[model samples]
Target: MGLGDFADKAKDAVNSDKGEEVSDNAFDKGSDKLNDATGGKFEDQIDKGKDAADDHVGNE
Candidate 1:
């Protein structure tokens, strides 16, 4: 209904197991595309950032 409520629901969804799987898959696919376009120049760095995000979400 409200912005806060919407944000809360989104946060809850993203913190769920299914949501994590979906998020990781999406991020990996996108990262792969970017890495391909850049000839793998930033793949490792991209992975590190994604991993950090996953760690933060998992901790929550």
Candidate 2:
């Protein structure tokens, strides 16, 4: 991947404890925005998506 992506991945790894919430909140916000925009069509996948997103962030 690109340097920016690598930098972000490293940052997230180093900041994982605090970053967990940060990542989760970001994922949740994105999910909420998408769900709201789509009128709940994606509601079922929101939680799983958020969890997967957050896991990826924390996985390093």
Tell me, by TM-score, which candidate is best: 1
lDDT by residue for model 2 over 21-52, one digit each (tens)? 66767787898998999999878888687777
C-alpha TM-score for every candidate:
0.77, 0.63
- Please write out the lDDT profile of model 1 over residues 11-60, one tens digit for every residue: 89988888888887877787788889989999899888877767766325
Best by lDDT: 1
lDDT of each: 0.81, 0.77
Clashes of 2: 0
Off by over 4 Å in 2: 1-15
What lDDT, from 0 to 1, does candidate 2 have? 0.77
TM-score of 2: 0.63
Q: Which 10 successive residues of model 2 have the least lDDT summed?
A: 51-60
Residue 16's C-alpha lDDT in candidate 2?
A: 72
